[model samples]
Target: MLREYLQALLFIFIAEMGDKTQILAMMFATKYKMSQVLLGVLIGSFLNHGVAVLFGSLIGGMIPANVLQIIAGSAFIFFALWSLKEDDDEDEEEGVRKLGPVFTVAAAFFIGELGDKTQLTAITLSVDAAHPFVILLGTVSGMLLTSGVGIIVGSKIGDKIPELFMKFIAYGLFLVFGSMKLYTSLPEHYINIFSVSGFIVFIVICSAFLIKPIIDKKKKGEKSSYQKAAMTLHDYMNQMKSNFDNICLGENKCGHCEGQNCLVGYTKDMIKEGIEQGTITNPIETDSREVWAKKAFDHAKIVDSLKFTLKYLMDNYKDLQKRDMSNAIRNSLEMALFEETLEFHGDINMYLEHIKEKNPFIMEELRKSL
Candidate 1:
C-alpha cells in the first residue's frame, strides 16, 4: 500500500507538469489568490480522480472502454470553446462567477478537468491495484504539487503575458488535447468532425479577438496606457522591496533579527562582497557613479510608489492574508494609481470601486498610506 501510494503520487506529479490543467491554474493565479487557486486544484483533482478510481476498481468490466474515451474527449472539446468564450466580466450568466474567488476557482477547475487526461490515467492505474485509497490520495497530491508551481510562477510573470494571448494558448491546447483524445478513444471507423471543425472555427475566432485589440489600439492610441502602467507598477514590487531593504541596511541603526528573513543582512553581505572584490556591477547599486546616477534616481521614483504599496501590505497583512494576497496587493496599488496622471481602464476602475465598497476601511487606509 505504501509503495502504491508513493508510485501513484510520483507518477501523477511528473505527468501533470505543463499539462493543460497546469495552464488553467496559472491563468487563475493571475487574477485570484495563491491559496484560493491551490485549494481549488486540490478539490478538483481529488474528486475527478476519485471517480476514476471507482470506475477502475468497481466497474472496469461493466462499462465500455470506448464510451469513457468518447465522453472524456467530448469534455475536452467543450472546454476548448469555453476557453475563448469567458470574458473578464465580474458577473456572468451563472452565479458561479459571483460566488467569490474560492468558489469560482473550484467550479472552474472542476469543470475544466471533466475529460482531463490525468483523471482518465488514474482510472487505468487503479484498475488492478489492491489499494484504491492510496491511489486517490496520491493522484490528488501530485496534482496539487504541480499546480503550486503554476500559481507561484504565474504570480511572478502574469503581467508580462497579455491576458488575451494566454487565452489563445489555452483554447488552442484544449482543442488539440480534446481532439487527440477523441481520435484515439473512437474506433478506426469513426470520424471526428467535432474535433477537426471545432479546432478550426475556434482558431478563427481567436484570431479575430487577438487582431481586433491590436487594430483598435492602433486607431485609438494608448487606450490601455493607464492599465499598462498599473501592470508595470505591480510587476516591479518584488524588486522594489529588495532595493528598499538595501536602503534600510545602509543605516547605522540596522541590526539583524535571528530566525527572520533578514533583507537588511542579505543586502549588506551582497554589498560588502562587491566592495571587497571590486566587482560591484549591479544597476541598483550603481549610484554615486557619474554615468549611472541619473538612471538610478529616475528608477527610485518607481520604487517609492512600491514602498508605499508594500507599507500598506505590511500594515494590513493580517486582514489581507485572510483573503487573497492578489486583492490586497492590487488594492494597495490603487493608492499609487490615483497619484498618477493616467485614467483607469474600465475593468480596473470597476475593480477599485468594488473593492472600496466592500472594504470601506481598506480604501480609507489606502488613502492614508499615500
Candidate 2:
C-alpha cells in the first residue's frame, strides 16, 4: 500500500509539473491569497480524483492485470503527446465570483480538472492498483504540492520560469514511463532489439511532429494571459513611480524626497494632528518607513479620499514584491485602525465597503489578508 501510494503520488506530481491546471493555479495566485487558493485546490482535487479513482478501480477489477497495464501504457503515451499541445487562453465565463473566493476557486478548479492530464493520470495509476483509496489520496497530495509551488512561483518570481521548459520535462517523464511499461508488458517475441529499435524510432518521429509547433510558438515570443497580467501589475508600479503619481501631495512630485512639500512634511503634520487628537502616544519611531504609510492612510480617511491610501498600497506592494517580504502590505493600514498609539486613519471598515462596491475581487483579497 505504501509503495502504491508513493508511486501514484510521484507519477501525478510529475504529470502536473507544467500542466495547464498548474498554470491556472499560478494565475489565480497572482490575484488571490495563498491560503484561499490552496484550500480551493484541496476541495477540487478531492472531488475530482475521488470519482476518477472509483471508476478506475471498478475497471481494474473487471480487466486482467496485463491488459490493464497495456491500456495504462498506451494512455501514458497519449498523455506525452497531449503534453505538447498548448492550452487555450480561455476566460472564465462562469459566475463563480458571486459565491466568494473559496467557492469561486473551487468551481473553476473542479471544472478545469474534469478532463485534465493529471486527472487522467490518477485514473491510470489506480486502474491496476491494490489500493484505489490510497491512489486517490496520493494524487490529491500531488496536486496540492505542485499547486503550492505554482502559487509561490507566481507570487514571488512573476513568471520568470518558462512554461515551455516545464512542458518538456513533463513530456519526457510520461514518454519514459510509457515506453518502459510497453517494453516490459509486451510478448517475448515482440521484445526483440529490432522491435524496440523500431518503437523508439516511431516515438521519436511522433515527438518531433508534436513538439514542433510548441517550439515554433516559443520562438515567436508569444505571451500567455497570465504573463501579460503579471507584466501589467509591474508596469502599473513603474508608471506610478516614474510619474510620481503616488506622492502624498497631489501637486508635489519629488518622489519621496525630503523637500518641504514632500511626504515627510505630510507625515509630520499627521503625527502632530494625531497627537493633538489624543490618538497617538509616546515612543513613536519618527524615522520608521511605516510612519509615512500611517500618515498617508490617516490623511486619506480624514479627507474621505482613497487616492493617497490606494497609491501608498500600490507603492508598498511593488517594493514588497521586489524584496519578497512575507508581511502583508496593509500592515500600517491595519495599525491605523487597531493600534492605540497610531491615529485611526480613515475608517478601514469604510474603505473595505468602498472597495467591495467598486471591485469585489480586490475586496475579497483584502478581507482574506485582514
Q: Give lDDT: candidate 1, residue 352.
A: 43
Query: Highest lDDT: which candidate?
Result: 2
Give the Cα RMSD of candidate 2. Answer: 12.8
Task: Find the candidate with the highest TM-score and give its number.
Answer: 2
Q: Report the C-alpha lDDT of model 2 over 1-370, residue by residue, as the tens digit.
A: 9998888888778778766777667766655788988898899889999989998988888988888887888888989878777777644415676777777778887888888888888889988888899999899999999888766665455446676676778788888889888878877788888988887898889878877776686676555433533443334333323223333453243244553233435334433433344222322332454444323423334222223334334333433342221112123333333332222233556766755665576556655534
For candidate 2, give the lDDT.
Answer: 0.63
Q: Model 2 has how many clashing residue pairs?
A: 1
Q: Which stretches of candidate 1 lie over 4 Å from their true place?
A: 1-48, 51-61, 83-142, 162-173, 184-199, 202-370
CA lDDT scores, all candidates in order:
0.53, 0.63
**Could you tell me every candidate's TM-score relative to the true structure?**
0.39, 0.63
Q: Candidate 2, TM-score vs. the true structure? A: 0.63
